[model samples]
Target: MEPNGMKCAWFQFLIGFEIMSLGAYFPMKVYVYTHDFEEGGKENPKKIHFARIPVIGECIVLSNNPNWYKVVLVLHTPYMAADADAEVWCVKITGSAARKAAGYSAS
Candidate 1:
């Protein structure tokens, strides 16, 4: 309702969208995969099973309002006894001694 008897389209449009709080923490569930990188390809029985994935820290959030997280942390969930490899990942990782002999070089 307006002075001219017309609805305010701009006001209605602004109300339709939602804004997310920047620094909010929420709980979420993550998948745990078995440490079976052998024969690396899709459709392996080892990869099919899903188990409890514990979160030692709060890198995830669960909210009723949809959020858009620009930076995503996609984990190729490791089967290690614990998430200890996180430290090693921050450093340089090396392959077999014969990696260069096998025809792979650092670019």
Candidate 2:
């Protein structure tokens, strides 16, 4: 096999491994949400809100603390395949200060 072909094979293997690992470690319910935005006009102002829905096969990792959770937003694009597309966009519902003040306790 050519060098590039070999590299691509290895890359795919690594990505599969990481995704399996994540699934094993942080298994939880995943919720899909979307936001709608309307263009503002003189007669009507724009309003936007995010609504949660169910998406199949989406990975969701729930934190016991209600602050931290892992959400699988989407598959990594081809450009990011080298990194195993394992990069997950993390969101913290609780602010950092609050966590620090609580000594990093969920309670």
RMSD of 1: 15.4
Query: CA lDDT of 80 in candidate 1?
Result: 58
CA-lDDT, candidates in order: 0.28, 0.39
List where candidate 1 sits over 4 angstroms from the true fold: 1-19, 39-106
Model 2 lDDT tens row, 64-99: 444432232433323633423223333333355445
The per-prediction tally of clashing pairs is 0, 0
Return the lDDT, model 2, position 21: 76
- In Å, residue 95's CA in model 2 sits off its true spot by 46
